[model samples]
Target: MTSHPAAEAFGATLTPGTRPTVLAVDLMRAYFDPASPLNLPDDGCLHSAARVLEAARAHDVPVVHTRVSYGPGGLDGGVFFRKVPALAQLVGDSPMGELMPEVAPRGDEVVVVKQYASAFFGTTLATTLHARGIDTVVVVGVSTSGCIRATVVDAIQHGFVPLVVEDAVGDRAPEPHWANLHDLRTKYAEVVDEPTAITYLEGTS
Candidate 1:
């Protein structure tokens, strides 16, 4: 099952966590709006993500969401905001920053507001999941090479298994998207498909 020489030699890879939690990150309007520079172009990931969310809800798994927000002038955004000026769209009440209806969190789901790419950074995500005894995080959302990748790496470091759904994460370009997913599958997380994710959620509750 190994895809690389080292992996085949050592058989080192990630595994799925038995107790599942659905984590939807940055499913915001900016990524879906063609006019926005953050637009992902292929919106199919949204539909796949919505399906995974629905399955999670049906099975009664814990759910959490993360969205980026910056105060006026983005002073709180720090270097990240300076590097990506386009993130300004997420500031305040901009419609582009709102969660996409397709994957928006329902009442009672934890909504984490963060300034950086990793959901666990500057947020209560790790402690919250750890407190609940959630062993694995099923992640879905935008920007495979950025936020998704960052979150996956941290999830494992924090002891929560990270399962990144390939069909449910998007990037501006295919190269970074595929490359990150590939590296993650071998190193940090188990990069699965939408069907596998749904199956995992269905088995929960």
Candidate 2:
């Protein structure tokens, strides 16, 4: 791989794991709507995520997806609902809060409805992964500076090695996207591209 200044300076490397679970985080319509305040222009990330999903399926790796949805009247959201008042609008019934069509969750795949950034926060994600014997996580999805970053950090804290697929994650702007990837590469997770991750997963399995 060609070296990037930040990546080189950090000297981070990902140790491939034999058992990997793929986590697709918040690749929903709210992130794609042109008028939405959170929309990221470089949404090609979803395509990369879809490719990773395909590879995961081919390898029979467990797949998990997370979306932020509040209950009716925002009862399930609590303080997080108040912090981002707009979340109240994304009630369980809101179609806009659903995963985007391009990367829709499969029938047997686990869909985690979380109100916070970290997928493991107040959710069954960690327990489910543990139950399934997952030791590594291949992460893909939107808002690299937000949910993706939170997931990476929490994955490490939860004892799972995080492998962040760079091209499969996006942010509202390039600056946050690049900065967060750099930080993740240095301190939290292994920042890699889709093909590298897919090949590693295939080889390990």
lDDT to native, each model: 0.90, 0.87
lDDT, model 1, position 96:
86
Per-residue accuracy of model 2 over 1-205 as CA lDDT, tens digit each: 9666864666567685778999999988888887676677977999999999888888888789999888788888888778876666588767668788877888999999898989999999999998888899999997899899999999999999999999999998899999999888889899998889889777765
- Model 1 TM-score (2 dp): 0.94
Alpha-carbon RMSD of each model: 2.9, 4.4
Query: Which digits, one per residue and each the tens of the lDDT, describe model 1 over residues 1-205?
Result: 7466674754265667678899999999999999999998799999999999999989989889988888898989999999998999888768988999988889989999999999999999999998888999999998899999999999989988889999999999999999998888878888889998998788776
TM-score of 2: 0.90
lDDT of 2: 0.87
